[model samples]
Target: MDIGEGARPGLRERKKRETRIALSWAAIRLTVERGFDNVRVEDIAAEAGVSPRTFNNYFASKGEAVAARQLERARAIADELRARPASEPLWEAITNATMARFALGQDDHRGAEDERWAEGLRLMVGEPALQGEFMKTSAAVEAEFAAVIAERTGTDADTDLYPRLVASAVGSAMRVAIQHWLRAEAPGTMADLLRDAFAQLANGLPTP
Candidate 1:
């Protein structure tokens, strides 16, 4: 349900979001343990303690279920950005909104000492089934982000380039930061990588 900007979620909205998140986590965990190809939608539904019919009501496929958190986080970021004070710099608002939504837009819910989840995430990432859904989700997120940017900056998302470009760049930067953290086994906090990525972007990405 679409609440007014800055409005608190009612109980029903909260419960629905929780269910979506639960299903998403279930899909991700099962994929991590058994690989994407092996995990069926029924398995994810069972893991999430919901019926397959209920899972179908929320998502179309196992891949969509796994990527559900991405949509949630992106929507959260858009709302966060909308709530920022007008006095705040656009880049700073973007950074803070992104931070509020997810740590570097990665699943940073794991403990700092826990590395197994990262490994699992890396392994699950290569599944062909998940990639297409993930890509589509990312595009949807970028378009939503661009619309929010246009609203904030008084630009036309459909015709003007600035909103779309900035949204895409921010999305790309977050993706790169998350990918680097996963692929390189980077020891730094995902927050640090995200901050550096935004800093470079805000600084016009001056050459080293």
Candidate 2:
């Protein structure tokens, strides 16, 4: 099978992915329930029905485990952006790729109702280790975005300014949209917020 369509992961690789996801979510939920400092690696492993050693094999720290899901989500978005048709506009491709991830039923990021979830997220904002891991994830994914955008625009990511600027702008836009959505009293769906954000981006943020 080629590297794309039919390249299914083997059983071991699939199992590893499952284990990693389980550990990641377990870390997040446990941390949210107990706060970051209270949630230990042992707790996360037990929650995921895996051994602590297995957790260690997958992640060096609880912060890394907790940040893994967000990293994976961003990675998926980057991959989707890279796969868009060559004819599609860059901003359009980015909007579509992000929307694909935040589609209703797949994930609902609107604030309210789930106070515990919101509180945990707020706590994560204050967590140095978690924030550091997330920033690292963002930088890595932004690099991925820069490379893909460069390819699409026929620019060099290393030496050209356009790719990095666009990548940074889009990344910041998404961050702002998500944070606002999470913090608002009755924030609307992520789709609406994302559309507005990307619209501003595509339109050069003209005065409202």
Which candidate's lDDT is highest? 1
Off by over 4 Å in 2: 1-9, 108-112
The positional error of residue 19 in candidate 1, measured at the CA in angstroms, is 1.2
Error of 2 at 170 (Å): 1.8
How many clashes does the backbone of model 1 have? Answer: 0
Compute each candidate's TM-score over C-alphas.
0.89, 0.88
Per-candidate Cα lDDT values, in order, are 0.84, 0.82
**Candidate 2: lDDT of 208?**
88
TM-score for candidate 2: 0.88
Error of 1 at 40 (Å): 1.4
